[model samples]
Target: MSNRPYIVGNWKMHGTRAMLAEARAIDRAAERLIKVEVALAPPSTLIHACRKEANLIGIGAQDCHPADGGAHTGDISAAMLKDAGAGFTIVGHSERRADHGETNVLVKQKAEAAIEAGMGAIVCVGETEEDRDAGKAEATVGEQLKASLPEGEAAAANVTVAYEPVWAIGTGRTPTPEDIAIMHRNIRAQLVEVYGEAGQEIRILYGGSVKPENAVELLSADDVGGALVGGASLTAESFLGIIIAAAGDDAE
Candidate 1:
């Protein structure tokens, strides 16, 4: 929490037991970098395995169901994720929003459920390429953020926001640092308005094909507390590079 850069890897639907080696390697590297707080949200199937392999780094789930239980088949609930050793869950990811047709209201419910189940919620909000092109990026993100977050101190304490433009995700394209900073500032303002002082401390991560090459500068942007990395985070080497970038400012 404490302003220490929170670098999280969203493995999405990829990874299996074979990838555990890479996760272990990432955990070993993370142990050496005390300044950065690293975590991985692997496929739900690997959450417990990853936790068992590495105690130093955090382990999370990519997504969770809003309901605690029922005949929701194929869907895992926040409580189930927690029981599986997931300390956090990423909600409202663009992929989930688009593929599953998840609405902001549903995202908000999932976030609240995560907190209720004793897990942190990394709520994602973003504008599609069309929205960005239309100069409604900030407006789109603002609306999503407002609708997707839960109220109260505990919710604020357990929530982190991520801005991953729909177009940029998995496309290797990213906004300039200035553009990132502007969007982050806008999101930060909204958080403050909603959560007051607590909002200022909510970590806002930038996720969009984040890679080692640009990790340093991107992580250095104003109000950019961390990153929600994609492909680059699949391996220990590349992911460690970004972790090292986060450690720079706090390196002794």
Candidate 2:
């Protein structure tokens, strides 16, 4: 709400209690900075535990089922996440899109469920380097955003969008800042079209290969609100550097 960059660390399949010690370390390292809003999405198994130990930081879940009631064994629903103290949920992550074969339509339903459950939805969208090289990245990502985002235009406060290039995720390679800027700017334009006036305020974070070293450049780029770190976020110091990098008004 403050226009501060909402930096979120996606601890994808990479945290245990000992790792939560690293989360606590993050709490300590970032305690003094009121400039950024930080959140961590751990494995769902750790959400409740994370909620208890969250302390000055926000805790999120990696995924959720579309239905409030379901027999989908091993699937946690949005209501369950809210009950577990998860303040947000990362929906349509690239891994979920690829591994689970989630379609934009399905992701839209899941996001609606999270919003109905009263938690923020970090909706993710991105394209492959191949798509970028072919100059179709913007078109592809724009289509995904059109399909996945709610048509009625949910409030910006309850939502954030993340651009996590499938090619860069976990590959240790990143898009050049210029490309990143163009894509993010494209995304903001699309959002403004879809959400009308409120979309300009929605946080649009850049994910993939986000580390302390590259975070400053990414955070400073136009339309890039923050980051969704994967590997670097496993540690406290690295993740804190990112949060600190995103400090201050993102709109600035």
Among all candidates shown, the one with the greatest lDDT: 1
- For candidate 2, which ten residues in a row score worst on lDDT? 243-252
lDDT of 1 by residue, 156-240 (tens): 8999999998899999899989999999999999999998898888999999989989998898889999999999999999998
lDDT of 2 by residue, 87-188 (tens): 889999989998999999999888888988889898999998789889899999999998998554454568889999999998989988888899888998
For model 1, give the 10-residue run with minimal summed lDDT.
243-252
How far is 147's C-alpha from truth in model 1 (Å)? Answer: 0.5
Off by over 4 Å in 2: 153-155, 248-252
Pairs of residues clashing in candidate 2: none
- For each candidate, the alpha-carbon lDDT, in order, equals 0.92, 0.85
